[model samples]
Structures are given as C-alpha cells and as structure tokens.
Target chain A: MSPSLSWIDPGELKETLSRIGISVDGPPAPPPSFRPEPSEDQPSPPPTPNTEASPPPPHFEPVISVAERIDRFARWLEQLTHGAPMSIADPEGLLIEGRGLPEPLALASVALDRALRPIRGLLGTHQVGSVTLEIDGGRLVQTIWVVTPIGRVALGIMVERPLEPGRVELVREGLRRVFDW
Target chain B: MFGLTIASQKGGVGKTTVALNLSYAMARRGWRTLLVDTDPAGAIGLSLTKKLSQAPGLADHLYQHTPIAGLIVETKLKGLGILPTGKIPADESERFTNGLADGAVLKAIQTAAQGRYDVVVYDTPSGFVGATLGAMRASRYVVSPVQAEPIAARGVMRIFEVIGALRAKGHPVELLGILLTMLHTKTQSSLAVAEDLWKTLPGNLLFEATVPRDPAFLEASAAGVPVGLLRRRPPPIAMVFDQLAAELEARLAPDAKDVANEPIALVD
Candidate 1:
C-alpha cells in the first residue's frame, strides 16, 4: 500500500469506485505496484537511475581481436567443465563464439534476446542480479554478465543437468577469474 | 480505406464469425473487402471455405517470396476476398520464433490490399502474442467481439489496457468499439451483465447492436457461408450483423476518404 493512500477510508473507497462506474459493495481492488512519492517531511527515496534509457556506449574495441578472445574463453571454459556446450555473446547479444551448442540453443538465441530486456528490467527493479533458464527439462542454462573496466560481457553456459550449489559457486568464481574482475 | 483487426485475448468469442460476416456486410454495401486470417489454427477457412484450407498464405509470403496478391482467393460472396492461413511448415515457425519480423509481411499484405480493397479485416489469434501485435501494428482500428459473459467482459477490458499501452508507446492504433456477442436475453444473469457493462464502460465504447445466441450462426458456419450471405430469405441473425455493419460504416465514414489517400509505409 502507498503511504499517501494509507489514509483512505472505506467511504472514500466506495466513492472512488462509483466515479469509475464500478458499483461494487466490497472494497475497491488494490493497485498493482503503486509507489507514492515522498512528502516534504519524509526523506526522499534513493535515486535509481534508468540505465537502460541511457546505457554507456561500449568502451572496448579489443586490440586482441574478438575471435582470439572467444577462442581463449572457449578453451578456458572447456578446462572448467568437460563436454558442456557453451556460447559466448556480447552485451548486445551478438554471438561472439560458440562450441558444441545444440541446434535448438543456437536457434533459440533470438527469442532469448527478447527475454534479456525484461531480465534487465527485473534486475533494475529488484536486487536479483543473475537469472537462469531451464531448457529441455533437465538442461540448465545460467547467464551472468561481467562489468569490466572497459565494457560489459555476457557469458552463458549450458550443462546437462541442474548445477549443484558448489558447481554454481565454481562457475561464478570461474567467470570472475576469467574476466579478471 | 481502413484496416481493422477484430481481436480478443480470449478464444471462442466469435472473432472469426464477426470478421467473416462484417466483410460480407461491407461488400454487400458496395465496398471491396478483404478478410485476412492470421490464426495458425485456420478457423476462417473452416468457417468460410474449405477448398482453400491447405492453401499457401501469409506465412508463405513472409517466409518465401510468394506475392500477397497470389495468395488471395475470391470467396463465394461477390466483392469479398480472403487470404487464408495456409500450411506453415515447422522450419517457418522456427524462423518466426527466431525473429523473422512481421514488419515486411504486414507491409506486403497492406500494400497489396490498398489498391484493390476498401477495407482489410484481420481475424487474429486468441492471445495477444506475436501475430496479434503484428496485426495491431498494421491496422488503424481494432474492434473486439466480446462474449457476453463476466469472464469474457474482463478480457474485453484487458484489450483496452493493451490498446492504452500501445498508444502510450506512440502506436497509431485505436479501439473502434466492443461488440457484444452470444447474448441470451431470456437469462437474467446475461441481461444483468450486459446492462452492467452498458452502464459502467466508458462513452460509446460498446456497440448498440447486440448479437443474440442463435443456432443460425452455427448452421451458417457449418454450411460454409457468412450468416449475411446464406440462401435463405433472411437468416435469423443476419439483421443483427447488418445493423452492426451500418453502425461501423457510419463511425468510419468521416475519415474514409482521407484514410484512403494516406496509407503509411509499413516499416518501423
């Protein structure tokens, strides 16, 4: 409930519903995701900038070349987990390099791009920073981005089954070390 | 010419029936009309004509380079045309899912219809997903046929929410009106719900003409003809659709000439 609307009485609720032509005897329906602005007496809420509206332009034009970086990362990921298909894409979702990815995963990347905006929006709104998708029942795909000093890089890995807690930590640590974050 | 999409988020609300009959009514009134079926289920072909059920259509035009003009079939009713949703292959569905955008397809269909038809009516799929959004983007007007039941009325309200969201994003589409279908006056609950919606919903959004629950519609559909075009002297529900057509024409009459002159290029 919004702080300002906390003062609303039952009579006002009926009156409001009446003005909207909803002649309901019960209380009016609650609003979805309403957040009232802070009053003068209250301290203002922390500013949450809409980074999506004005994302910083990509900073890195890698001198090492994209193909070289992709090859290096693919080799490193192979050492971390054997026989697991993986694909690496930039923050813009263009596939940089991939190895052993199934046809469905390769083809579903476009639909997956549509999900990225909503995932970013959810991250912006909430504290959740990482997202995972379960594909083909048991197959799991976890994605996390590394914000380096130069630019953002998104890495995704697909494994045969759901990752154990220790394996998830290992994956995160591997990404952190691989990106030198 | 005005491009209208008869859409609803809920199924079995007579969207195909409305699209077919309305096209016939407009054609009978000396307007060249085209009905485009975008539903993958191909209900329009089942209801209107079965011969073209497996015919290649919109998907073919989008996936392949098949011209939209070649896909159009002349219906039994004079002055009316249909572009059926014919045989989309598995790979084509994969392409659509993999971002074969509808912008080009919408442009092709509308550009073809512009020179030949006075109105293009799109009968969309049930949910407000990819095909519905594509149709809405191409259309200037959206007229939703809402079933005269509580749950279906909620779906009608949901359509308004989607229309508002589209307009907020600067899309030029607008809601024409909500047509109440399958009304049974003898039932108190139906009459009460209709009366409630009539009084509560905002100005001029509900159509004055209501389609009664009649077996004539099913009979006409089973016989593969619009209720308005049946061989009988006058089908029982034909007058209801005629009145609806007259009202719609009157509403669209003021800008009809202006719209005919200014068809926009279908690109983002």
Candidate 2:
C-alpha cells in the first residue's frame, strides 16, 4: 500500500534555518556577543586580576550556580576566540560548557580533563601548563590547565590550523580572566 | 494480517530504528503490532523494553520447531510484541540459509502470523540477501530505507527490482515507499543527495516523513527506549516517526477495500 503525500526535501531544513538567521555551516555565532564591541581608537584594556592576598575561597557548594558561571565563561571564550570553539569541563570530567567543538573533540576533552587531574595535584601554586593533543584527521587541540582555588579548570581550544605563539597566549589570557585564576 | 518489512540493500539505512519506533507508534495508535527482527545484526533487542534473552527465537521456531507463540515476547508498549532474532547456533545459520533459499521458512512464518496481528513489521538486514529475501517473501508490503547518499539512493533500485520479481512470481507484495534516512540538512552534500533523490524518484514512492539526523536517536538507543519514550520531552525526530506511522496506518487501513484480498496462500 502507498499514500500520496508531499515529502519535505532535506534542503528545506537549510532554508528554515536560514529564515531563523542560523547558518548551515555551523552553530550561529553568539549573537555578536552581548558585551560591547571595543572601539577601534581605544586601546584594549589588559585583563585585571584581583590583587587581594587571598582570593575568595573557591565557591564549589552549588555546582549548578558554578555551572552557570562556566556557561558565561564559555560564551566569553567564544567571543574572545572570534567564534573558535572551546570545551570547558570540571575536574570530575563533566562538561561544564562547550561550543563549536566537534562531538569527538568534546568527549576527548573530558578524557583529557580526567588525565590531567592527577597531574594538577603535584603542581605548585603559580604553575599553569598547556598540552597539545594530536587527534585523528590531522587536527590538534591545545588544552590548558589553570589552577583555581576550588580545583583545576580544564579548557580545550580546537586548532583548525597552525597558529602563532601570541594567539595561543591570548587564549590563555582569556581563560585567566574568565575563571579569575 | 498486514505485514510490512522495513528493509534495505545497503547498511546504515535506519531500518531497525524505523521498524522499532514504527511499532511503538502503531501500538500507541491502538494497533496490535508485532515487530520481528529478521536481521541478525539488528539491535532491536537493545531498544526494546527489556533485554531480549538469548533464547531460541524465529530461528528455533523455523529450524527446531519451537512454537512461534512461545517466542513472541510482550513489550512495555501496550499493543506491541517483539519476536527477537535470538541467538542462533553457529550450525543453524547454514541450515536456515538453505531453508530461506527455498522459501519454506518464510511461508511457514506467514502462515503462523496470519489473522494474529493487525500489523507485523519485519526489520531486515543489509543487502538483498538471504535474510532480506525471507522478510520480503513473508510481507505484504516493503518499506525500503535509503540513506541520504548517492550510493544508498542507487541501492533503492535493487529493492524495487526485488519487489518486481516477487510480483511477477505471483506474490502480491508491493513497494510502500522509499524512506530517506539519516538526512543531515545542514550539510551541502546531504542536501544535494536528498534533492537528487526527490527529483529522481516518483513522488508517490516517497513518504512524506523525512527523518533528520539527530543525536536524540543515540540518546534513546543508549537508554533502551524508542525516541518518543525518551525520559525528557520527545525530540523532533521522534515526532517525525510518529507522523510517519500515522500516515502508514492511513495508507494501509485494514478496511481499505484492497486489503480484503487474502495474502498469497502460504505454501506450507
């Protein structure tokens, strides 16, 4: 038995997304970032760090609230990287936030977080380190472990192509500002 | 009884997913449906309410003379039952191979299913091989799944040819439609393939439902439930299958005068 009905073409989905201002190429860019665009004439301000002797004890009690903050940080990283994806996960390997990274990259970042957790225990207070993970498809992911008062914060920056050292340092600086570490 | 086989000549065409979820949808609509897993590689058991035991299944019913009724397991779905492709002994695979080639096994299965189910859906394996032939032989209609790819679209021709040969041989089975599956509209290539298929295929031979590629299926598979039965709100993909099921029911209504004709007489 067969019925006469018009089937929606798959291309229609692309058209629908386009109507909603979403790109078929990838996830839509973060609404042009809620933060104000820096004026061209004004020099960019350096990240400001709290100079207090003891930073407020890492607030770990409400994991939900901390997770929300992590989302904001992830969005900020998205803006900072000009839409380059980033994966952020807690020390326990739970994905705190992520954008643009492929599924395999996100899952791999979780594993990386778990792997780097043990190493964080042996590091000194001021030590922050980055490791490069070679993945399939000849891609590379640069993951940084920033020591926070609460625990280690793992962030992964997906590298689509070769980049300069200054660009990598800017990503690290963004992480430091976002996590306040 | 109306028996529909969800089959394909290519792998990864979403036959099992469609068959299993369609059964659930049919059951929800108050149709007493039975989903039979003819494909040895099918993960139908994993998506069912309970893990199907490694007991004798259709193979035993065919080769060892186990009662088909005994092998039919009730699922969590109210009006649905599952006859799993249970653990077939390594030795029995060869025996069944010969049985399928001769069409004896399928004829027996058809006879047993007669008058018992409102709809019996069979999930067949990849390719137009032994298992697929057995399913095709027993069904009144075939739903050929074609993945949204050029090669997969070409495979749809083989299914039509099989249905044609069966029709010429006096078997009354008909091709219901070609279901496009695993379609990712976000990708240009996926869109190109789908558009090409739509233009090339006869409009009536394409179901109105297009299953989008979604991670929700994986979530449901992992949770051992139909996409519609996922714990949270059912995803859009789930709704797509539900609509497809409803449309199929309308097309294959039991009271639709054409269905009054008896199936080809079971030889056995």
Candidate 3:
C-alpha cells in the first residue's frame, strides 16, 4: 500500500524552529489571490505601485553620534560666548568639533592639551579641570577639560569678557552630560 | 576571619596582582588583612619583599612544621601582613604539594589567623589543584581573576566547575565573582571579549569594576610594593583596586551600610 503525503505549514515550522532558538526565514509571501479580509475599524491602505520612488518612513527615534553631540555643544557654546572663537578636542588633542575659533587659538588649545596630558593620569587622578590664557588683544582663552569614559575632552573659548567661575563650571557640567561621564 | 582565595586556571591572569592589591586595599580600609601566598613559585614574596623570598613561609610551615605566627611578615601598611611561600626546596616540592593537597595545613593557618586578622587573602597559583584546591577548600569565598583575552575568558568555566565540585563536596566555598583584569580598551579583541563576558555572564557573576592594562603595575612590581604605594600620589590604576575592594565588601555584606554614607558634623 502507498503512503499519503502530508504537508507541514511553513509558518508553523518557522515558529517551532524559533522556539528552539534556531532562526529561519519566514515563509515567502502568500500568492496575490490569497489576500486577507481587512478589519472594519482599520482597513489596510491601498497598495502603491511606485513604492521604489517613495521616501522611506521617518524614524520616531534617531540615534546621535558622539561627534555630532560635540558639534551641537560647540555651536551652543559659541552662541553663549557671543560668537567668540571656541573649539573642542579629544584626549589626544585632536579636534572633534569647533566653531568660529581662529587657527592660532586652536593650535594653542592643542598645545596646552598636549603639555598637560602627561600629568593627567586616569579619570580621577590629578584631574586638570580648566585653564585660562591671556592673549595679545587682552582677550582670555578659557579652556575647560573633563575626563569622560571615551577620554578627556576640552572646550576652549576665546572672549574679551571672561566667564564667571560658576559659568565655567556650568560649561564643564555640560561637557560631562554630553559624554555621559 | 573572612577568607578569600584568588584562583584562576590560566597563568598570568593577574591573580597575584589582584590578591596583592586587594589585600592592600582591604588593609587600608581598616581591615586587618593577611595575604597568604600558596604558590610554590613565591610570587607574592618576590613581588613584595626580596628578603622574604628566601625566608621560611607557608611551605616551611606545612613541611617542617614551622610556626605560622613567626613567619608572618609585617608590611609598611599597619593593617596588612604577609605570609609568603617560603623556601619551597626542589627536593621537597612533592612533600609540599602533598601537604597543601590535604586541608590540615590550611586549617592550621586559619586557626593561627582567626583572632589576628579580619580578612585573609590567599594568592594561589594557576590551576585548580594542589595548593589552589587546598586554599579553596579552606576559603569561605573564591574570586577568579580572568584576563581580558579569549583563552582566559574561556578558562572561566573551569573555575565554575571547580567551585561547583568543591560545593558538592560540602565545602562552604562560594564563588565571589569573576574579575576581568588587564583590559585594554583600545584593543578591539580585548574590548570585544570583555563585552561578551559582561553580556553573557549572569549579573552577579562578574564584577562591575575592571582593572585596566597599565604599565604602573610593572612599576609597582619592580618596586616590590602594592601599586597604591608606588608613588607619593598613588597612580590612577591603584584606585581601581579601591573600587574592587568596595565592590567586594558590598557583595560580602550586602545588608551592611557603607561608612561613606554616614554624614559627619561640619563643626567636628
């Protein structure tokens, strides 16, 4: 006697495999003639033929990068400093982001960072919080450095009017928040 | 006395370094800590005091019946004491191993340290046999130091098996946690291994504090002292041990309130 063939549902097979921690691709889409009945309250939208030309759906949440965060912070600091020159650098004194800062001041910030980098050990050891330098035009180049999990980050601002100690602390706190230090 | 044995299956996984610095950190925290070297290689003695390397230590006490009290070496830290692996002669190495294989020598050491030290940290050699097994058999807790490398991470299971077997044998030894050491964040493989361990291991199985790969450890080893005492101001890496010690205290006594949480009077 010949045995009758039995077919296993692809969806059931996929679910069983997934339950056992084995991932397999879902079954191919059903044939066009097998469309499901739309619910009365929420009907499916009409299919659009030009799907490839349409823009992708917007994401409700967007992921932000550290470099982008630093850039945003630098721009905000620039507005606070009244368009004064400013820059932010990594632990290695490499510029991550900058705003309206002159070449001389940027070089000076990097130089200061390199000079003080050796003395600074780990995150909590002998931390050099901030440094201020007087330039030729009676302007103060104030630099605040913070050690983040990523590494040390410095924010330098050149302005004729120096920010108060509290304001400088606010800047430091802002940098810390940006890096989640 | 609280007994902690630093055990690992792989060599150079920072077991000795963790044991040495952890004991120092505990001593600094006002715990009368005694560091006992169970390794026949005399790593603890060589790392701390050169003079004590040749001196009679735990091995001598086990083999020749030397007094444990007399062999305890006082360190610069007032709260810390050292019992080095003294003079494991090549001829009597087998005897020493046999002595450690049995738990009587460890019981004697514990008895001697009962009232003297608040905590006794044992620095065992690599592998879960002989001296290491003896130390674990005598210890109330075991903390495994796993280097942040693929092979070292894989060896962690052997520690679990050893601890499990000891418990099955009715030993009161509990696995404290696996400490990831010598982690280089810049190295892709190192970071990957550390991340994998953190994600894969149970929340309570791994320590929150990690030891970074630093040259200061070598400097401290050369100077024959704990990394915390390497310079006038302790290196930043030294503070990692302080964090580890704090975590250990928290794990060992979860219900106990931290002294730091207590507020002090400004006038006083």
Candidate 4:
C-alpha cells in the first residue's frame, strides 16, 4: 500500500517562525538603492533569511509509530520462518504449524494448529524486532524475539535457514518492540 | 555420553588455545568433537573462525524459550562443530548469575548437545565461580590449564575450591587433568612449578605433556590456525597437543584406543 504523507504548506512558515520568536513581518526590505550600492562593501545587503532548509535538528530517531514498525517486523519474521510449523503472521492473524503429524503428516498437522493460538495476542501488543538464526546440524533454525512493554518475547521460528542482514534488521525492530528492548 | 569442560578461573593460560587445539587434535585424529563456547564473549568461536558477528550463542538459548539447536554452528573444519555464544553483553555475568549459578546456562547446553556429540568440550567464562560450576555440572571432567607460574598454580587451588563446592552438592564431576602450559625450557620457576604440582596433586589427574611458551602459539591463535595445522616450523606445542589429546582420550574413555580406532558419527 502506498503510504500517504501529509503535505506541508509553505504558509505554515509564519507559524513556524513565531515558534522561534521571530516577528513574521518578513525582514524589512533594504532601503531602495538606485542601482544597488556598489562601493567596497558600502551597503549592507538585506538580511536574507537563511532560506536553505536547515535539516531538522538532529533528535533521537522519532519514536516509530507502533503499527508501522509492527508491519515491517512481521515481514522479516515471516520471511525467515518461511516453512516452520510454528509460523508467525503479521501483527494479528496467525497459523502455527503443529509439529509434524503422528503418522508422519498427521501429527505435524496438529502441531501446526496449536502453535498459531498465541500469535494473535502477540501481534496485538508486540513487534518482531530481532531474529536469531540458530544452527541445528548444518541447516538453519530461527527464533524471532519481539519487543513489548513488559519484556522481550520470543516467537518460535520455523525457518530452516538464515536470512540476509537487511531482512534480519526488520525482524529485530519488531522483536525489539515485542521485548521492549 | 560423558562430557569434559576445560576452563580456567583465570584467563590467557591457553584456555581458548587449549580448547581449540584439543578440539582440533581430537578432530584430526577422527574423534567427532563438538566444542561449545558458553562465554557470552565468544572467544572460543572467534579462535575457530571469523564468520559469526552476534549472539544466540549458547547463553541466548537458556533465557529465550526455544530449541537450543538454533545456536549450534558447524565449523569450516572437519569433525569439530561449535555452539557459539550469542551477542554477549558486557554484563552477561550479572544477568546469567542474577541469582542462580552460571551453570544454569550450561545445563541447557548439555541438554542441547546430548546424543549429538561424543565429546562436548565447553570453554567457559573466567573469574566467576558460577560459570565454572555450570560447566562442571554438565561436564564429566573439568580440566584446567595452568601456566608454569606461581599465580597460575595458585589459580589451580582456587579451581579445586570451586570443584570441591560442587562435589559437596553431589555433582559427579572429576578433576580430569591439569596441563602445566606455557613451559619455558631454561626457566627454573616453570620446572619447579611443574615439579611441585606433581608432588602435591595426585598422579592420575596430571597429564604428562606440557605446552611450551612459544611465539607460534600466539601467532597461530592470531591467524586463527591451530598448532596441529601450522605449516611453519612449529615448536613442540603441536606435539604436546597431540599428546594432550591422547592423554585426555585415555583419561576420559580409557577402554577406547587411540583416536585412529574411533569413528565418531556426527550430527548432520
């Protein structure tokens, strides 16, 4: 989905200047010069309000909106945990793949079913923030840690291999949210 | 299946070197060895390779509710596998031993490694008693490497205290062997220290081999190469390790012959 951003109006410049205690009667024009004064630096040029947009004062990265962060984290968690039965879905709905079925497929199907139950509650409150690629033998195993108000919550990952660094970051953000780290 | 944890109450006495060389020595001789780096700092993993950059190390598995296998890594070398420590925070000791013994972390490491490796060698954290005890419980034998110095020998007594504490609690751990590391050929202090230890400690727990104080030991460690594989004109350290591995095998599983006779079936 294309994210819609609110457009800023230049007219709001007046209000912004007032915030810094600058009188909005735009700086007074320099006295009219017949053929602008050309002496060696004889006349003061009109104080050109530094028009260049000063980059916003560096601040702690603004708190990420809760929903947006969650979405990003979910994508990473899903990618890393692609085929594990205990699959976590976006912030709300989920399907936990049960351990393989008893008769091979039968028991696994059941494990997949029960695993999804905790995800909805997890999604509602947390964002996946970090992914730990655990190695089991030569293959990959994933555990997604989430950040929340109380503490870090770990979501069992079902992925069989490791994810690239870029993808791991998004999941880390989500987990940081779920775990409150 | 029994396990051995080679650790030190102190650092730089060839803990990682011993652990890595012993691991490589065993692996090269064909005993499947699984090395577990439980130091949240991951020095053991660092000595083995340069690939890993973060945690989910053995310690991470304990706090996070998940399968421990997620942290195990198969090294580039043959026969030696590793379970690396995860993003080790500077305060892992504070967190790991907030209340419980550091061994709590190792219990999970042991559980995770069961049935997977014939020999699980844990390179534990230095200083605190908790990490040592944690390694002790999960390990069948606790081997310490002491440099031939007054202080390193004193450290041995300190380790014995920690082991004695564990024994009082009913842990079946044994002081497998004490390796007098970093031997200097001309120094009387080193020779005296080794002699004193032999006289004081029981004969069964001491290995006949002594690792030499050589520049190659540090260079190999810096290059991430084991002494056993050093292509340069290696000092006696490599041979000492070869002997150390054999002594350890005979000490731990005496019924088994040299590493040549054993074929360890690896996990994966």
Candidate 5:
C-alpha cells in the first residue's frame, strides 16, 4: 500500500503480526550492544572525534560495516529458519511465504508497526523478501528477518507458528540492546 | 575460471540438482571441478557421497583457518572434488560471520583455487541470508535457479536486486543467468510465468532449452547420483540435461569473458 512497484516492508508487517501473539523463528538475534565504552575483553576502539571538526575518511568505512552486518544477520536467520521458505511479492508488495500462515503473522505485523513507528521519523524502512515461516496448526511461532541499508531487520511472524515466550523475551531484549530501545 | 555461486532465496528449487549436474557436466567435459556445499542441509554431500558425521569442510576451514585445498576429498566421480560442510556448518559458521572482519572461507578457497580448479561451484543456502552472500562474494558469477512460478520469479528478481546492490557497492560480482527449472509446461500459468521472466530477468539469454521437469532428477536424488549419470527411460530429460550442460559449459569456461563484453539484455 505504501508504494507501487515495490516489495512490502516485512519489518512493519512483522510488528503488526506480533500483536496477535504470532511468533517467528528466522530474524537475527539483534546485534551485540555497541557500548560507548569498550568491554573488558576487547580493547577500546579509536576514540570518536568531534563530528563538526573531524573529516570523514577518504574512503567510506561505515557502509562496508553495514553490509557485513547484513551478512552476519542473514547467516543467523538462515541457520535457524531452515525449514520454511519466504518470498517478496512483486517489487515491494507484502512479503509472502509458506501460505496459510496469516493470523499470527498478521499480529506480528502489528507488533512491528509499534516498534517502527517511533523510528519512522528518523530511519527509512526497507523491503526484504518473504520471511521463512511454517503454517503449524494455524498459529505462528517464529520470527522472520530482512536485510536493509542500516542493518538486518526481522520480518513479521507467520501466524502458522507463534514465538516461544522465552525466546521472544530474549529477542525483544536483544532488539532493545541493538537499537537502545 | 568464473567462480559460480548457485543460490536460491527459496529452497526446493533444484539448487543442488543444478550444482550436482553442473559438476558432472564439468567433469565430463574434462574440467577440474569442485562443488562447495555451503548449505547446512548438506544436500551436496548427501547427494555426492556418504553422509558425513564429522569432517573439515567450509565451516571448519573458515573458522579454524584450515588450508582450503587440504580439505578437498576426491569423490568416486572421477573429474570432481568436493569440499563439503558436514553437520556443524551452522555452529561453526556463527563463529566466523559474527566474529571475523573479513571473509575467511572465501579467502582460503580462492587463494588455493588460483590454478587448481577450472571451475568452482558453490551450492548456496536458501534465502537471502549471510551464507548466500558469503557464497556470492566468494564467486564473481552467480547462477541462480528458480522454480518456474510467479512466486518463484519474484524470488529471482529479489536476488537480482541483491546482486545489483553488491555490484553497485563495487563487489564486482555479476549474475550469470537466471535458469528456470521444474518446467511444468502442461500448465499454461507456469509457461506464461516463464514468458514473463524472460522479459524481467537481466543478462545474456542462455541457450533457449529449458530443463524439463522429470522423475530422473528425483530418482537420482534418491540414488545420490547426478541425473546425467543415470541411464534410464524417457531419455528426453537426460537429453535436456545434456543441452543444459553444454549451455552452462560454454558460458562458464574459464576463458569465458565478462558479461559486459556483450550488451546486457533482458529476456524481452
């Protein structure tokens, strides 16, 4: 609905689906927290410079980092969500996969809506392919994911499978840590 | 040699079938071929040789920095070599993608394959996840197989978007072609869908022969042998495979130049 000739934003759909208690299995566990101060095991990275005064590197490094992160997250999703296959509709139409997995996925789309609304004014969203999902007894139990310019994000839940509450808590916390939510 | 990564954003698209037959075809043509299975499902290993419970494949080589060629295990199939990912591809994969700054396995294999392999086929995992990207980065030419369906065509387009993004970022990887499989010609819908994709997909239109869906691929899957090796009935599918093999061979010869050499053309 947002745009013609494009794929749907799976993250938004996932949030909406989570609302009705659908869980998904594919999306990455959010990234390890980016601490302002270095963790004990690792030495501190080079100190941040004053943005106004510091010149950006001649070659862009942050862009490369994001691409690498997508790869990292994609790997996580692929490993856990081995069974189901997801696909993006033409262009950016709603992401679809494993038919009949709607109820819980619809709810996860709701949850995704809640999460992205706050960030919408700041970061634009991306359209990724169908989240891997299974239609198990008409309830969803897993998370799906998509890769974006900023990083890899979770696709909405498939109603066929609901997220396990414990794992949801863990991923929720991880999302909080990743975005400082 | 253009290192080719065969990937699918969706599974059950005959990715392994393409990989297996492609390997057999290469070997039959007297090319030194290596099929690398980055798929955790281990379909390549399962199809090519005995199921491996424990062994050093890509994950081991990537995580432990094992010498790439050292992991090569020659198969019963004469002109082929397999570098497999046994049981722990996932566990070991996390240790690398989550931890390493650079591609460990890609670097290892590419360096070892400078002259050793005339063709390297990477059987990618299903989906647009990390494994597929890693496989794509390792190979400059990507060969994708899509089920000849509307939904499947969408997957093919999405993957091209991915390939396009990578190339835009100077990844230098190029899509070789989008090959259609499971040709259900009886269905008008499927045929129409294929017709539509020819107009949508990018790059050189491959030899026009489509790989017809046949029970031989399944039987070979059951027997853990390449379809090209199966001597069976309805010889048509086998003949299709022969044509498919020749088209790929012509396209993938080490001397094969960049796709840019010819103006990029869509199927339309």
Candidate 6:
C-alpha cells in the first residue's frame, strides 16, 4: 500500500514565505466590484459598466512555417547536444533536417525509424518515446519519436558516449517546446 | 514588492492555471498583483485576452528597451494587472530567450513594479533554461505545480536541483512548495502518484491544497476566464483556489490576524 500524503501546517508555510521576504500585510482596498457586501442601511450604488473589453479572436496567420520550425529545431538540437551529429526525418525515410550527419548514416537512422513504425503499429502504440542503439563503432545512436502539430517525426542523434539521463530529459523537453508536441 | 514565479520543468502541469488563478485570488484579497507572462509563446495573453497578441510586452521591453509601465494591461479586476509576452517574431524568439538569460529584464520589471504592485507573479514557459531560469533568478520565491503523474514526480528533482544551485550561488530564491495539480481522484494511478509524493517529499516542501482534475477548468479555459468566474455561482472546484490563497496568506504572513475570525455583535 502507498503511504498516505501529509503536508506542512499553515504556520510553517507562512514562516517559509516570510523568511523569503514576502510581505504579509495585504494591499490597499480592492476595486468596488471586489469589495465585500454593503451593510443593510447602505444603499447599493448603480452598477458600473465593465471597462474590460473582449479581445479580438486570434486570426493571426502562422508566423513560423513548418520548414522554419524544422530548421530551428535542428539548430536548437545541435546546440543542446554540443554539436553532436543529429538528423530529423519523417517515417517514410525523408530527411527533413539534419546537421553533420553523413548521407548514409542519416538515411540509416530514418530507415530504423521507418522499420519501427510498423512494429509500434502492430503493438497498438502510435508513438515511441525513445530508442538507443549501439553501432559497431562503439557510438550510441539515440532516436526520439515525437508527434508534433505537423506530423510524426523522428529525431536522431549520434554521440561518442552515452547521453546522460538529465541531458536526455532536456532533449525531450526541448523537443516538446520546439515542436509544440 | 514580493516576486513569485510559477514554474515547472515539465509541460502541461498547470503552471499557467495556477499562476492565473493564484494571482487573481491574491488580487481579490486586496493585494495589487501583476501577472507577468515570460513565455516566448505569449501563453498568458493567449489564455486570457487575445488582443494582447499585438501589444508590446516583456519581449519587446527586453529587446527594444520599451518602458515596462506602458506595457502593463489593466483588467476589470481592480488590483490585477498583466504584462503579456507581446509579439515575438518567429526568427527572433531565440534572441528573446537569450536576452532573458541575464535576468536584467526581470530585474527591471521588479524595479518598475516596486511602488505599483504588492506582488508580482510570473508565469514561465516549460523547461528550466532561458526565460524560466531568468524568472527564477529574479524571483524571491517560486511555486512549482507538479502534475499528479509518475513522470511529473520524476521532474520534481530537477526543480530542486535548480533551486539548490540558485541558492548555492547566493541568489536567495526560495522554493515555496510543490503544488499537486490536475489530480484525478477516480484514477488509482493519480492517487498513487500523489501518495508517493507525499510520502517521499518533506512535509514543508509540499502544499496541503491540491487542485483536482475538473472539467470546469477546461470550461473556464474555453471561456478564457478563471474558474472563479465560470458561472454566476462558480463551480465547487473554484473554491480550492480560495483555500489555497488562505493557506498562502497564512504562510506569507503567519503573524497577521485573521479579520474573518473576529466576532460580530448580534445587534448594534
């Protein structure tokens, strides 16, 4: 059985924030609408118009194109992994973006992603978080499959050493941020 | 002014929701509050008023030296104000993030808000780098909303590590506590995660109030209003924020007397 949850009391929590220099004294009186109920004898004032206007609906065109996003993602990945060889491709083995990836290795990475797609489908899973492969040359190839607003794409990186767990988490977060997954 | 940042390492953890409602709650409690949106994507603007998309905001102020005072968008809520992310060009987004890394923009905001606001709440983008890091560095306190899931639980350690590093460097940023959000009471996995977190984390590190997973939040978001304003009478879930606010007030000012506790004469 999992342990039941318990948290700090209000006094202790207050002490924590106070020690950090947060002011305990409240601000001045709020707006009229936010004020407490009026006394029985006090006549209610006429209701004032709400000055806050409804903002226009978002009709702005997409500022960043798919190609630009891919390019930015590639650049961000390269910087994140310290210029490690990286490639991004569709499931059909089409190279959408890459940096320092030899043509053959890039193609191979996409092929690997392509091959895994059917396996994932057969297993009733639409996405694979990540896969790590050790090639013959002692290099590690890490691939993260992400489903973005555009489509499903595979991000692969080649590093001489195994990527640290924290780094991998960062990479995953970067993927989410850049790709809007 | 008190600087509080709502941050999380993982996405979809209800950071924006917490920031939005908590700031509004604080404002309703008579605290002049400024809600600053630090996400390059302008999430706060998008979530609330859509017209702010074209307004100059934090990014504009950071990059173009725009005055922070003029950038503030007043709301119908008297004590509540907002500093939207403004328009971030696609190509200049990286530059904007890089600009925030130095913490200058946040410092400027705090300086500008000093006399104007009683508290400043920052809603940061996901991940601990760039703008989030800048906000953390500039804030005196941070509250992380941890989604009730195993993956989100794993991400809590990263927040601690980052806060630890910040304090080690003498930045004086405090981790107020971890708030459990999006809890699904019916889901055993979610309950288990909450239980595990309560058991694993120190008592003072976790908040007592937990935000449940309610369809009302979705409804509120669709309507672009905080849960407190969802209906003529807000749904029951909206009261959780008031509870959370009371808890926060108690924590922020432990010695402050509670006027609500005072007795009222039967006839006067």
Q: Which residue pairs show collisions in model 6?
A: A13-B251, A14-B251
lDDT digits (tens) for residues A4-105 of candidate 6 = 322223354344445544333433212223223447998877775565765655676544433345556666776777656676665445445444343346
lDDT of 6 by residue, B43-102 (tens): 677666568756789977877888999999998999899999888764465677768876
User: Which residue runs of candidate 1 sit more than 4 Å off their true CA positions?
Assistant: A1-181, B90-104, B258-268
lDDT tens digits, residue span A91-174, model 3: 654444444344346557768877875677555464676788998657788888877876877778876767888888788887
Q: Which structure among the candidates has the greatest TM-score?
A: 6
> What residue pairs clash in candidate 1, if any at all?
B1-B260
Q: Write model 4 residue lDDT over A23-51, tens digit each, in one string.
A: 33543222212213347967776674555
Q: Candidate 1, residue B147: CA error in Å?
A: 0.5
Ten contiguous residues minimizing lDDT sum, candidate 4 chain A: A95-104
Give the winner by lDDT: 2 or 4.
Answer: 2
Docking class of 1: incorrect
Model-by-model DockQ, in order: 0.02, 0.02, 0.01, 0.01, 0.02, 0.04
Off by over 4 Å in 5: A1-181, B52-54, B89-104, B199-203, B232-235, B252-268
- Stretches off by above 4 angstroms in model 6 are A1-181, B253-268
Better model by lDDT: candidate 2 vs candidate 3: 3
Stretches > 4 Å off in candidate 3: A1-181, B254-261, B266-268
Docking class of 3: incorrect
The TM-score measured for candidate 6 stands at 0.63
lDDT tens per residue, model 1, A69-93: 4345556676766635555444444
**lDDT by residue (tens digit), candidate 5, B18-101:** 887878777776667888877654567766556542466776766576777788878776768888875563334444333322
User: Model 5: how far is B140 from its true place, Å?
Assistant: 2.2
Which docking class does model 5 fall in? incorrect
